[model samples]
Target: MTDFDATAYLPDDLLERIRSRAAAVDAENRFPTEDLAELTAAGYLSILVPTALGGAGLGLAEAAVLQQRLAGAAPATALAINMHLVWTGVAKVMSDRGIDDLRFVQTGAVAGEVFAFGISEAGNDLVLFGSDTQAVPAADGSYSFTGTKIFTSLGPVWTQLGLHGLDTTDPADPKMVYAFVQRTDAVETRDDWDTVGMRGTQSRTTVLNGAVAPADRVVRRVAPGPNPDPIVFGIFSVFEVLLASVYTGVARRALDLAVAAAKTRTSKKTGRPYSDDPDIRWRVAEMALAYDGLLPQVAAIAHDVDVLVDHGGQWFPRLSGLKHRAVVAAKQIVDDAMLVAGGSSYFQRNELSRLYRDVLAGMFHPSDPESAHATVAAAWLGPVGG
Candidate 1:
């Protein structure tokens, strides 16, 4: 708990306010505007920016801790904010490695600019390596992205979108263009974000009809597939760790709720609290064991990223594995908590019910189970055909 203390960055009163709004945000399928305001005012959005740039100047280790705490109170709000943090975190990574390419991202974040991640596309299994969206290079070295990006969190309020697309106009030297586009008339947001859980995120579909990212905003132009580029490493490391932190927070809340329920609810036949029941005690213990294992793994990986521990090629596998474990464990913990709470938790209004839906969204994020397994297997046993 000491390692994950969120109060050091976020006050108890702020968390209470966020927690109080969770039910409403989820129920109404509305964005947590107030939560965003408070978090912004408290400088939560700039946690990863450098202190020299007027930010909290914290590393991924501290950011992970705060993310877990924030999600425990409001999962959707945290998830929405995660998109913004990803850009700043990536900027931090680049800066640490002597690359000043993303300093604009860091400065913009501190200036109250919300950066939405718009990399996810429909039927694009290649993830970071390839993009279905097209990045057509223009006369002035700028690029116009024209394709559909799905699951764009902060869709309603983002000032800029950090996205990537395939540039194949020059077939001889096709590249993946990574860039940021400011909100403009060319960008269209489709109001189609209703989902089973994490509803407050309002992660709608974004259709880019030649949305332009000026030459200066153009960040990288690497090959379509994997390379040792610092930007690639920065995106993967920060995204996976922060994502894992959010779901881990969800698991922690579920475990705590289960324990409270077990201690308060009495069994009719035994005329005693369910806490006295051996079966209930065992279930709670199981939940605790799963949650306890994830916390240290999250902390360790985040710490490694902070200290620049060179795991070499093993970094992706380690990062993906940690995310996979945290998400899977969180889902399992929520399922157990629902059972411990009995039929009351089956209600739509129940917090456990909301968590059940929210946790499921974890499976859909990047570094998914299949990809994580593939990455780890490749790391240990070599490529599938090799």
Candidate 2:
């Protein structure tokens, strides 16, 4: 963890520029187009693609480090990019485990194509395992997906949408189809990304009215409900780890802001800076402690994924718990930062206020509080029915 240099890829100057635009991007409720353009130019889109495929060939752990740095400056922008990384990251995961099925995804990223994750569906709790969308298979092995996908990040410019749908063509056994569809007439992007925070993401709704994935683009056809499919594990593992990275970065930024406030903001009562205030010092220490605790866990798990550490069945719960803790810790750190920074942070224009709003969106993301708890409980205490 100490050896990896996150700023090596996303340098401080570029991040500073992105951070400068975050407020306006959020306030205007638009995608971070400039950030995307800059990141794409920086080869960020192919972070996970193998060097053999003309990418950086970085591992998941390194990617986590980079994401945390990016998120610290501009969380929404990092998150908007997270979707694209998930696909390429999934490809890396599969590749690491000796599967080259999603190799084209890697090359596509290298060819300057943005991939968006479109597996999420409204009211669909069985994420990555099942879907409400329907997949109709053709004689040519192509499949047309007809359903709506919610929270489609990178909505404005994703060239390929990696999505899933339930295929019931085999009446006796239903299989979940995972495929990629290019942006075309069949795909509709609803401009409805107005949100409380993270508006810069513009993770709008995608309505796929029989959008097609050619035989080559059709990746997985695992049966519904907890299958031992590589794609499922790849998506879940990479998704959870990267999500944790982004939120942990948010917490790190808030902690830094609180420390800065403590050193600079003077306290009239004590005739000294807030840093001299014992109460303020204690609060700052607690926030630091909380943020510090999660770093090792996030790094270890991400590295485990990279090296293919066989955690066996405990993988799902471990990943879920990492994301849960990172988010919870980030939200707490931001709240404390606001308190430490005082009234100035309450204003909408302040970065802490923006972070406060941005962190709230974390709770709504997958591996939500309830589901995370359930996953951990079932993993540790055995399934309820057993």
Give TM per candidate: 0.98, 0.99
138-188 per-residue lDDT for model 1 (tens digits) = 999999999999999998999999999999988998999999999899999
Listed per candidate, the RMSD to the true structure in angstroms reads: 1.2, 0.8
C-alpha lDDT of all candidate models, in order: 0.94, 0.93
Clashing pairs in 2: none
- In candidate 1, the residue pairs with backbone N, CA or C atoms under 3 Å apart (3 or more residues apart, or in different chains) clash, namely none
Deviation in angstroms for 271 in model 1? 1.2
- Candidate 1 runs further than 4 Å off: 1-5
Per-residue lDDT tens digits of candidate 2, residues 148-188? Answer: 99999999989999999999998899999999999999999
Candidate 1, residue 193: lDDT: 87
The whole-model C-alpha lDDT of candidate 2 against the native structure comes to: 0.93
Error of 1 at 369 (Å): 1.2
Write down the worst ten-residue block by lDDT for model 2: 1-10
